[model samples]
Target chain A: MVKTHIVKFVGTSNFKMFSNHMATIVRLAAQQQQQQKRGMATLKAISIRLKSVKNIQKITQSMKMVSAAKYNRAERDLKQARPLGVGTKEFYEQAEIQAPPEDEKKLVIAITSDRGLCGAVHTGVSRNIRDALLADPKERENTKIICVGEKSRAILSRLFANNILFVASEVGRKPPTFNDAAKVANEILNSGYSFGSGRIVYNRFKSVVSYAVDQLPLFDKNAVVSAPKLSVYDSLDENVIQSYLEFSLASLLFYSMKEGACSEQSSRMTAMDNASKNAGEMIDKLTLTFNRTRQAVITRELIEIISGAAALD
Target chain B: MSAWRQAGLNYINYSQIAARVVRQALKADLRSEALKRDEVNVKFTQWKDGKPASKYIVFILFYLVVL
Candidate 1:
């Protein structure tokens, strides 16, 4: 019986890591005439695995709750600031500004979160920028990257190492404030990269479950100044126009950051909720398997006892 | 009266102003001493007595009760 147990256990390589204990018990019971030991061992294994799955469910459920709380405030913040971003962009359209000249440097600011596990959020932004660059190899060479989150930086830095201007870490650790966006905008303006135009690649929060990656133009200093409709505005000093450009850039970044933050929280909540549900379903399946196996062992033991009594008679 | 309002007319207003000021001051304490002091360095710890030497309030209460 012991030899049979070892052989049976060896064959149970296909059993799940969590199910290994159950498989061990099943193997031990393969040739045993009595049933108490095997039943206890197998039952113990199933219970242990069930407990772990239940713990996982608890963790996922709590994480979902935390993100759901954050989602509400982030949604409100994005809604409030979205209009200002629209207004800033409209000013550029009214000024009849065009895209930067082919010769000038292009900048892409990829906004992402420092933390991940929020349902493939950063990949969309990274993919969009990569695709855009691949589509235009000419612009790719001339382009520089400013990644707002470590996640995006890790992804893009590998491919566009030389083109990276700088990386801002510890972003979106909390709900983004305008000050946070302002600091990043200030860094870009001070870097003196002399980029002709800038583009922001961010996740647009469409609803609770869906988001889309999109890009918005951060009009260049030269483009804004050279607009044909510039003459319509009262005469302004070069320094003033430069400051206005900086303010607009900061506000646009703030709006995008808020929207992206909201999307992150909502997506995380949904992902965690789904994980908890899947864990529950797995637990249910395992419980069913455990019951069926236990019942079979019990019935087989009963039949063996009855047959042995008949043989004795 | 104008000077009084500048200083926050009564105790309630004055306390409110103080609370706001304290909050702002605390908010700017970005590199908090408490966080740095409490940071875990588990990898290189000496493992003295197989237990932590102190855990803030636990240390104080132990002295009060045990001694």
Candidate 2:
């Protein structure tokens, strides 16, 4: 009975402590609210902020709509470009073309866009490549990078320094064209820097909600020429093989660009949509706060008038 | 979401796969003509990199006529 009484007394003291803490919190909150009642300046400031927030919401909502529209056309272009890219990819797979040893020279083409605000679409690919290269000693040796978008170029240039061989921009905006890819590949080919094996690094759009940093491999001539089953191809000459490499490079780049475009557009659409939603929520919260402040001001004014009248009486 | 986290082993480059299968249906060779735009399907669009000045349009028109 004595022990039970002791436990009860301790419990009550704990409860009292908690209640006291809550009361102090309430008092602090009341003090903060009273401070916020500083007459006109706070009210004016809130109104200005409210107006700006509303305007920002409007702009983000419109940007979301524009991206949604562009996303549809980009999806269509991606669909159209796919069939054009399939054959060359198949040839490499079926031929079981050898890939040069990882230690050998490698080329990675990063596909991204110039603009941003699409939730790290460009940085995801570039950073992934950078980290991967840093992790692998073999990969770090003679791994040249070609950046296909301005954002990726800017980022990877800072990270990779001399490793960036070519930078291609003005891509991923329009429905990607085969002509553009061909031109870029030709330009790189003419630039005279070569690689053992090449890969196109890009954002692969799996669905409206998902994307992946993907690599489409392009093996070099030595690797392709020495494929264990290359005899099955029955091709004639070295020139055919070289042209085949060029053409496949172009086709794959074209298709990768289209896919990147689709991913970028859809990503932008979703990112903008989320931004607009967040802005809307912020506006709602700000409006409620503004109304509360206004009410406090009015009540304070009424109280002042009544007290002044009482004094006169 | 990150792409690497979402990637599955079954994943393939769908565009390249589709391109391979559509050649016979389109009645065209996939190699030389893969990236070529046929004359009939070609289009020309006039676009300026920011806002085009009035002189730029006139110059473009003159260049088009010359072509």
Candidate 3:
């Protein structure tokens, strides 16, 4: 009876070992199947990424082309508008119209645009104002900001929310006009901010690839009247002065808007061009990776089939 | 009195009228190009509760375009 019990225990131990071995085999088979699925999933992911990258490349390329055309038109319009700016500025310089130092109230007209993705065009203008405001705390207290475009407003509103008077939108959608300039100047005139001095800060279009922040000096009626050169001209009456002031303001605004628009378009062109180039590089790398993975998947399957056939034989 | 003030028009309105006349006075090809700048399309929105208000208030400004 003792011999029979010992044999029964040994038989049960052998059966347990066989079952454990079978379980390990099944686990191995499941892991291999999972690995194959993972390989296919990776291939699908790479394909999807490659497709999306291609689409992005196409969009950037189109944007670059559109900006190029707009830049050309802006450059042409800028040429005609350049003389107008020079003439207006020359009058101010000759008249020696300057704001008195004692005048504390100030206005800053920041020129940018509604659109973005132009790469630092709007930020450059906003940064200039921020620097000025930071340099003089007193100026910050006395100054009123008029944002000509939505982009500059968005940037300055974070800290100087109260300083902003208003934001002008629906601009930069098309070529700026004298009428548009007049409308903006009209609003400024009527806003009753009554600033003693002002400056129009804008991005001056230097070339297709470069731009510089520039400021055009603004003067109130008092400064214009107090100018020493005002004595040189005879019979310059109040109405004439008013008309001239209004016209000059409009002219300057028009010129600055044109310059800002040109700079915006050129910068957008450069930004889009760079984006397209980067997308192209990514596409090349992704295509190489995608092809390599696809080839590897095929090779892996072929190897599996061949090895399986060998095992069968 | 200036014709603009006499007509009860501000400088902006006067300028628009003057610009239209100038555009009309331009030579054929230049006139077409210059007139294109006369078009003004503006939209104004009032925000409430951190969102743009649902109703749009359209204010149509009249411009006297000289033929």
Candidate 4:
């Protein structure tokens, strides 16, 4: 009876041990499976992010190409207009010398781009204009602003909305023709408030990557008011001068628009380049995790097989 | 002779079981370390720039328009 009891006790203990060992194996397997799931989820998220980054890169690249093309055309146009603009300025200066004095109000036409993407282009232009306006001791009441581009309107409207006499939005997407610019110029000239001078603020595209905030005086105050002899024009001839004035303004608007577009593209390109580099690093990490998980699975299997074979023997 | 052979088989089984458990533990540790390394690599990759891409886009646009 004692011998039977000892045999039964040992059998029960052995069975319990086997059950515990199986339980441990099951638990380890479950844990590994969970880890794999988590790793896979992480990898999926990374891949999604990478795809989005790639899309952004493509868009930025296209924008860069478009901007480059626009910049080339704009550069050509600017070159063509340079000689004409200089000649006109010289003629105006000579005419102003002989013109009579009159009440003149200063008009500032500030040009900015509609879209935001180019780094520092719009902000720089706005800051330059603001500084110029503030530095002039001339009373704020005498200063009038003509904003070109939607972004310029939006920004300037906040501070000088009331002072904004006119906004030209059409110039943002395409280069404003001479006719469009002349309309703005004529409006300023006819606004009943006599202005002494006109100034244009715009980004002068120096290169594909470089731009400058250029402030140019369109008309001199003293010359326009102090000239002794004024060229008197009948209504019909005055209409012709109006057209020419508009043409000049359009040329300036066109230049600003093209330069802004170029700057936007270059900035986007740099941003996308950084994103691509980051995606590459993420892929490397995910690949490592995948490899390690696979190796761990194999090691676990090998251990289980070796233990089972020994138990069979 | 039969009793000795049985005892030897029991001992070998126990040793194999112990080795299997140790190997499983080692595998677990290796897997955990690999996961950690992967996480670190992902983090390093994600934050290439200090600022988010969206913010950078806004900054660039503002620069182009205002500058």
Per-residue lDDT over A227-254 for candidate 3, one digit per residue giving the tens place of the 0 to 100 score: 9898776788888787777778878888
- On TM-score, the stronger of 2 and 4 is 2
Residue lDDT tens for model 2, A141-211 = 67878778788877876667567766776765566666667666766676677788878899888888788
Docking quality (DockQ) of candidate 1:
0.02
Model 4: per-residue Cα lDDT over A1-313, one tens digit each: 2123223422422223233443454455446557767433343433443344345345545655666666566666556656655555565655554322353467777777566555566777777767766676463556777766666666766665556666655554654443344444545554465555667887765665567887655644344434444363234243344344444444444444445555544443443343334334444554565566567767878999999999999
The top-ranked prediction according to lDDT is: 3
Q: After superposition, how far is residue A148 of candidate 4 from its true place, in Å?
A: 0.5
**Count of clashing residue pairs in every prediction:** 0, 5, 0, 35
Selected candidate, larger lDDT, 2 vs 3: 3
Weakest 10 consecutive residues of candidate 2 chain A by summed lDDT:
A1-10
| DockQ ranking, high to low | 3, 2, 1, 4
Which residue pairs come into collision in candidate 1?
A: none
Q: In model 4, which regions exceed 4 Å deviation? A: A1-41, A92-104, A135-138, A220-222, A225-313, B1-67
* Per-model i-RMS: 18.2, 13.5, 3.9, 33.7
Runs off by more than 4 Å, candidate 3: A1-40, A232-235, B1-3, B6-12, B22-34, B42-67
User: What does the lDDT read for residue A76 in candidate 2?
Assistant: 79
| Deviation (Å) of A12 in candidate 3 | 69
Candidate structures ordered by lDDT, highest first: 3, 1, 2, 4
Q: Which 10 residues in a row give candidate 1 chain A its minimum summed lDDT? A: A9-18
> How well does each candidate superpose onto the true structure, as a TM-score?
0.71, 0.72, 0.80, 0.53
Model 4, docking class = incorrect
Candidate 4: count of backbone clashes, pairs at least 3 residues apart or interchain: 35
Q: What DockQ values do the models have? A: 0.02, 0.04, 0.21, 0.00
